[model samples]
Target: MKEKEILINWMEEGMTSIPNVLLKNYRRLQLNETEMMVLLHIYSFSQKGISFPSFEDLSGLMTISSSDCAACVKKMIQKQVITIEQGEQTGYEFYSLTPLWNKIAALFESDARGESLQQAMTEEKDLYSLFEEEFGRPLSAIECETLALWIDQDQHDPAVIKAALREAVLSMKLNFRYIDRILFEWKKQGIKTVEQAREQGRKFRKPANTEQVSRSENAVPFYNWLEQ
Candidate 1:
């Protein structure tokens, strides 16, 4: 293959990665904001032909457990956002995205109602500033509100929200939406104090089964989603 052809071939894995400063806008279903964002990040990383990151790699990079990553991958497979297939040549798993939404929906689909998510976002005027200050990037307005709804549950303290954001940025390697999910998790874990969070992190980091821990780490998210 010529250089250009080689580059093209490497990238033509039929892997459809949605790109942008606002890739999470494409997310849907009952997924928590973090799971949705994590799916996008994983898909984007795989689009570069990186293959799947090892469990340790994913855990460290995503600031979540390997099992949580695996569970999210399973849900992504269920959603048909991505599909995993055993590789014919390498005897490993390969993955691909199905709907070519950007080209298809972006061209043919129009919301004549003028009352879609996009419009709602446009109306939430201060959303971008609030999101960018927390996440280091602008969030379309409705996403900001969705995040706000999560973070504001039970307690609506701006200080709490800001502190959660700071901790997530430092420890989570998180995209904007994940701050909400982590806060939710923290709340459920009774992690109201810095000492509690430190203890929880240490407990989770203890060495465990290499196989099971890397496959389906969290059931709480699924249960919580189901209850919600």
Candidate 2:
């Protein structure tokens, strides 16, 4: 009798898809534009089963010079965003983005398991400390309730809500109403993660949103937006 072997081949499978977390969080990883583009191109090629791409092959598809691509590739390798290995097909060097994806996945998992606003404030995260760090004072009771509401009723991810708070602080618009407005807009757009919220923020500079932001700055009754 002959022994049978089971094999699983990714190339035999269909289209290559990237995770949303990776796409949106690349900026958080501190990847520059060139490194991001280089990693993306390599990913595209790998999806098409092209294990190895020459510097010329990679640079030809973009307006960047081969030297620039080479530099970016080197940076990506150093940053562990990509890894090079000898492929079995031809024993030539190939690049892989598994390292990058692993880092992205770990981040998402951590966020998923991380504490909620209330738990963190009372427990390990010491969110009160964080709030003090940002606001230069301990959070008031109503402010604490607002944070809890953002976590509980709104079901907004805690990290995203925290990020919104940081954004409001940076914009000099720190207030419960302002933070609520930010959460509302994000919820309207179906943004559930910090990465999605961050990505949207990058594209959120428009006149209408600016007007809305101005309105959000006006003193409204606490939690009034929830009723509206």
Candidate lDDT values, in order: 0.57, 0.73
Off by over 4 Å in 2: 1-16, 88-90, 116-228
| Candidate 1 per-residue lDDT over residues 152-222, each given as its tens digit | 45553444445455555545445544656656777787767756655554554444566655675652111
Model 2 over residues 5-122: C-alpha lDDT tens digits? 2223433555657777767999878798878877878887888878787789889989899999999988888888888988787888888778887988887777766754446556
Clashes of each: 1, 0
Candidate 1 residue pairs that clash: 67-217
Query: What global local distance difference test value does model 1 have?
Result: 0.57
Q: Alpha-carbon error at 67 in model 2, in Å?
A: 0.7
Models 1 onward score TM values of: 0.34, 0.45
Best by lDDT: 2
Model 2 clash tally, residue pairs: 0
Model 1 C-alpha RMSD vs. true structure (Å) is 27.3
